[model samples]
Target chain A: MAAAALREQLNALLSSMFASGLVDDQFQQLQMLQDDGGTPGFVAEVVTLFCDDADRIISELAALLEQPVVDFDKVDAYVHQLKGSSASVGAQKVKFTCMQFRQLCQDKNRDGCIMALAVVRNEFYDLRNKFQNMLQLEQQIQAQQ
Target chain B: MAGAASAAAERKVTIRVLLVEDEEIHRVLARALMKAVGGVELDEAGNGAEAVRRVREGGAYDLILADRQMPVMDGHEATRQIRALGVTTPIVGLSSDSLAADVDAFIKAGADDFTPKPLSKEKLNHILAKFNLA
Candidate 1:
């Protein structure tokens, strides 16, 4: 496909992401920072890092909750880490889910935490899929150049 | 946009910054953000303890940006430790927790100010201006 058309499609996808609250201005701020030079693909790099971080933290949370005696403090800490990473990359939905998950952890509600973890994992996967699409478009744009 | 970038360019002072963040991705983002601002020399410390050690060994940083929550030692304790060492460079606390108590705790621990996490260009510049680094 032509670079301009690919660019427009990418823009439209990004716009829809914002409209759907899948991402926020922090993501745009990251893109702007990338445009200012130094790191050519800063946003994509951060997003990839975020995905890895999220995967580890989510798995940790799941395992912790699976133990006979769940450690609420440990659960809360992992959720906090996930929330921070999500906010850094402007993954709005995942960050929000992490917030709720943290509250459940704080309350020491084992059942609530399990439910929240499932929800947050789903949110993370959804955002990750969108990010993969965005990254693919970015690569195509670069190839055309 | 263009105006902000130009203004940052006009500052022309290479402010040396020690950024204390546990997460590598955040450190990477900070590096890019500072580069956008155009004249910043950034150093990294994984946690508060490392930050304190760096300052004690005479890092000569113009500013310190400490993330409030870290594994080894949090920003609050690090700020207190750095202050105990008599290093009086500006310490700005960063956190995703915007709670008033958190901000107050950081200031009480000797941080000069507090800013919410995921630092944007404007916030970075604001910190510089507030500390006279700009």
Candidate 2:
């Protein structure tokens, strides 16, 4: 596909994602921060970091929660980290999930938190896929340029 | 110590800033943000305790931007400690948790202001101008 076509496709995809509530204004804010003088792709770089961080946190949560005697403090700490990362990238859906998950942690509701953890993990994966697709489109656009 | 800081302030055209953040990435981001504003001489501390120590060994810092959450000591306790050390430099919280209660905690502990991440040029500049650091 040509550069213009790719750019348009990327734009549409982003717009639809926003409309569908997959991301929020923070993502647009990230885009604006990308033009760091001669440097480019700051948004993609940071989002990629968020993805990696999310994956590690998700696995940690899985293992931690699987223990018979769950340590709620550790659970909350991981959830808090996820919330910050998601908020940093404007991963609104994931952040929302994390907020609820953290509250469950505070309540010490093992069953409730377990449920919230699964939901948060799913949201993280979904957001990661969206971010990956967006980054790929971004790279193709830069290559064409 | 005060006289030394005053002398340093008189000798420089640039605004001196002490940036306190544990994460290397955030420290880099903070440095980049300061560079964007121009006329800034920036220093960094890895965490809250280090930041307090730097303040104790005083120099003229126009502003201190500390990550509100950190190991060893948090920005809140650091702020309280810095204030206790008789350092009057303006301190701002680099807060990720922006809840009213959390923000209030920083303010109660002696932070003059806050700028949330990922850092914004507009918000930071506004805060700088408010304190005459700009």
Candidate 3:
């Protein structure tokens, strides 16, 4: 009975995540990955990879933005990668900000890119926090079981 | 006492769920709704590749909700790949597209269900009911 209750709590948590938009289609993709043999913990593994990737891209973007003579091409490339990653994970707001950042890069508007960076960072942080919460909840449920 | 017993009886077993979306806002909202329903264990991934990776690593989930378009991989390719991998977990295609043709494509791609966005609570419940997840 307790196990069943825990599972219900977990599902409710997932639904809340969808409602909040902290995840996207990429999350769904992880679900599908569960079919194959020799691959357990697929969702956690994938999310960790995404978190790592997101962190790296954000740092790279920051470094590029801080350069004295902003390399628009480099910034654009980073933005493109960020956009692709965010889109894959269904981080819509972050992807949208990346789009704007890419445009700013095209225009060579350093300030605009920097501003967009803030938005992307904010979105990423929000997602990170939400994901962390879910992870914790999962842990709790698992412990109880 | 009878009503209480019936209410408890009405509760269903928890269904393992996987949610694939590309939008952050939608993900958060969906998570909240799932939490409210209280009978599902959910995991998430960002794209088809990641989704596939997770499913491969984890055991079979009871349900999968996926978005249509994404960058690293789209939902169609993901669905096809999942089917190819021999995972029989029920999958549902989610999109903002409101066309029957689009819905048909999802079915063809291996999804067992199709849901259109801006997802409403009622609609989500309906999808769950359709899949017997509710």
What lDDT would each prediction earn against the true structure? 0.90, 0.79, 0.73
lDDT of 1 by residue, A1-145 (tens): 9999999999999999999999999998888777757468888899999999999999999999999999999999889889889999999999999888888888999999999999999988988888999999999999999
For residues B67-129, what per-residue lDDT tens digits would candidate 3 score against the true structure?
A: 877669888889999988899888999875547998999999999989776454466678777
How well is each residue in A46-111 modelled by candidate 3, as lDDT tens digits?
456557778988999899899899989888766766665565455666777877777788999989
Model 1 chain A: worst 10 consecutive residues (lDDT sum):
A32-41
Residue A91 Cα positional deviation in candidate 2, in Å, after optimal superposition: 1.2
Put down candidate 2 lDDT per residue, A19-137, tens digits, no spaces. 97878887776565555433376676677778888888889988998999999999888887777777777888998998889888999998998899889878878777777788899
**CAPRI grade of model 3:** incorrect
Against the true structure, whose TM-score is highest? 1
- RMSD of candidate 3 to the truth, in angstroms, is 11.8
DockQ of each: 0.58, 0.21, 0.03
Tell me the lDDT of model 1 at A136: 99
- The TM-score obtained for chain B by all candidates, in the order given, is 0.92, 0.87, 0.88
TM-scores of the candidates are: 0.94, 0.85, 0.49
